[model samples]
Target: MLGADFYMPTRVFFGENALQRGKEMLLKAGHHAFIVTGKSSAKKCGALDEVTTLLQEGGIPFTVFDGVTENPPLLTCFEAGAKAAACGADFVIGIGGGSPLDAAKAIAAFAANQGMAPMDIYDDAKRLCPTLPLFAIPTTAGTGSEVNPYSVLTLEGGMKKKTFKAPDSWPRAAFVDPRYAYTLPHGATVSCALDAFAHALESYLSPKSTVFSQTAAVFAAREIWDVLSAMPGEFDVEMRTRLALAATVAGMAISVTGTGFPHPLGYSLTLLDGVPHGRACAAFAADYITYNEKSDEGRALIAAFAAAIGTKPNVMKAFLPGVAEVDFSFTEAEIAERIELVAGAGNYQNSPYVISKEEMYAIYRAHFLKK
Candidate 1:
């Protein structure tokens, strides 16, 4: 067990119809609100309508700023902050996927105090002030941006994907309703589910992991691997519910322990190659774990836990999708170069073992290349 501090300040409302409490939660923050959401999916599913309606019924005046992009940009968050100020929003509401939720957090923090750019906030979180109250309603189950204090956004000038972590950024309230994710596109479902798995596994191996965080992360990994990997192409309701639950737990685990290695390296791919965060991270899990096994840390425990949950085979298959008929389309040199590039990312700062740059490069090539 490693020594670490655990801090979880967000109030969460879970399960079906959990979103109906949004009205009460918003009222606690204040009457005037600014809502942030992605432009397309939430509107199409009518999830945005439910949130807006709840605010109206509660006699809360709110304005929805639906400009969030796939990988939230620093410039967009800055603009959104200005909009919130114009609306006189006393509280900021985030009502969509992780992108929108994270955007709301940054925008809310800057709405009252223009001390920092969203990209710069990650580099210098002290610039954020304790201003406009924060609340989150997640339309998707992955990222756990609702409860966690970190927000990942794409920075301008060189396409850097940055991280923002501040105590004041954690939402005062977060509403999780599995019903909202049912309408997510198939690609998004698979990608975000994989992302949750990465969160669970990364946190499980973190040097800062405590007993509680390890248990939450491992169980979340097991549950998600069992549910999402086993679900048929049609995406059954029961399976989706189980996946959603697993995502929430994984999010909670990362909130305390934090993730390592694969996340930073994965962020590079998402930012540069245009791969989705979840998919890019998931692709590296097997290789990264193989590197951990060399240190003889938690290898047997991981394998046993995975098998006990009846998920080893399916998860293995799901993550290494390129092994099958799916074409990876990467040359041997390109793969190796990418591995070396990500090694310089300093992800080792959060890794359980200090991995040398060369060793990190080898790990990527080991799994990516043929046996």
Candidate 2:
């Protein structure tokens, strides 16, 4: 049994009217707020305007620092942190998609210090100081960044992305509302949904899973799968609740257990090919189980998860447009090139089973067929 220690410090306000309580939350935290956003869309969506009016009415001195990008970069984080400090923002608010929310976490940490950020994330142990108070306002129902403890950032000229975390990495509070994601683009919608699914699958199968984490992941997975199974529908409160809850639960699971090889491999697809995080992983779901779940118990658990989502045990068979075989079409040279990079990831060591580059390539080719 993985006698894991778990604790979530973020004060979460859930459901439909949660955003209405933002100003009250500000007063509780004691602050001048710095709002972090991805772009002008938050302003166009009137979300920025709405949050501003609320903070102003409550007399919370606030400023907006809006330049976060998809797959947030270290420079973006440093720039945002500088802006927050320059504005004297005592409390930080992230009011866009997961990128802004993740940016907020790093910005909060970096803002508390007064020095150049570490050029190498692996070497930047001193860059992450104790963070200022953070409020995560998730505009999208995926990535679950609002409720998690780690931030995934793209390093400058780095071959691989870096995951940042410490005891102080958790958000101080999270304000999640489904209404904000009602207008998400179709591709974004698919990508985010896929990201949530990876969280569930990874959390569920981790040898680090505890009874508490597994219970939470199972329910979250069910809800996320239901929402994805029936797409292009109006936002269901239940789905939003599940996404928020799943993100939080998965976040907790990762805090203790961490993730496996698919995540590192998925990064390659996202960075190199620009496949969104979630979809890239989904493309490999069937293969992930095949290569990693060598145990009968593991396969049974995966089959159960698929059945829960209305898919069969052999769901992976559908991914192959032609015949199924161990041989993949990717050049062996290409697979050999990334073998060490994927294997070297810290998270890959956390996987229950030992994985090699050949297995990783097999998993990738299995899901990437052009069918």
TM-score for all models, in order of appearance = 0.88, 0.87
Off by over 4 Å in 1: 1-5, 115-120, 123-128, 311-346, 363-371
Give residue 79's lDDT in candidate 1 (0 to 100): 87
Alpha-carbon lDDT of model 1: 0.73
Q: Residue 57's C-alpha lDDT in candidate 1?
A: 79
Q: Lowest-scoring 10 consecutive residues by lDDT in candidate 1?
A: 320-329
Q: How much is the lDDT of residue 54 in candidate 1?
A: 77
Superpose all Cα atoms of candidate 1 onto the true structure and report the RMSD in Å to 1 decimal.
3.1
Candidates' RMSD to native: 3.1, 3.8
> Which candidate number has the best lDDT?
1
Candidate 1 is scored at a TM of: 0.88
User: Residue 96's C-alpha lDDT in candidate 1?
Assistant: 85
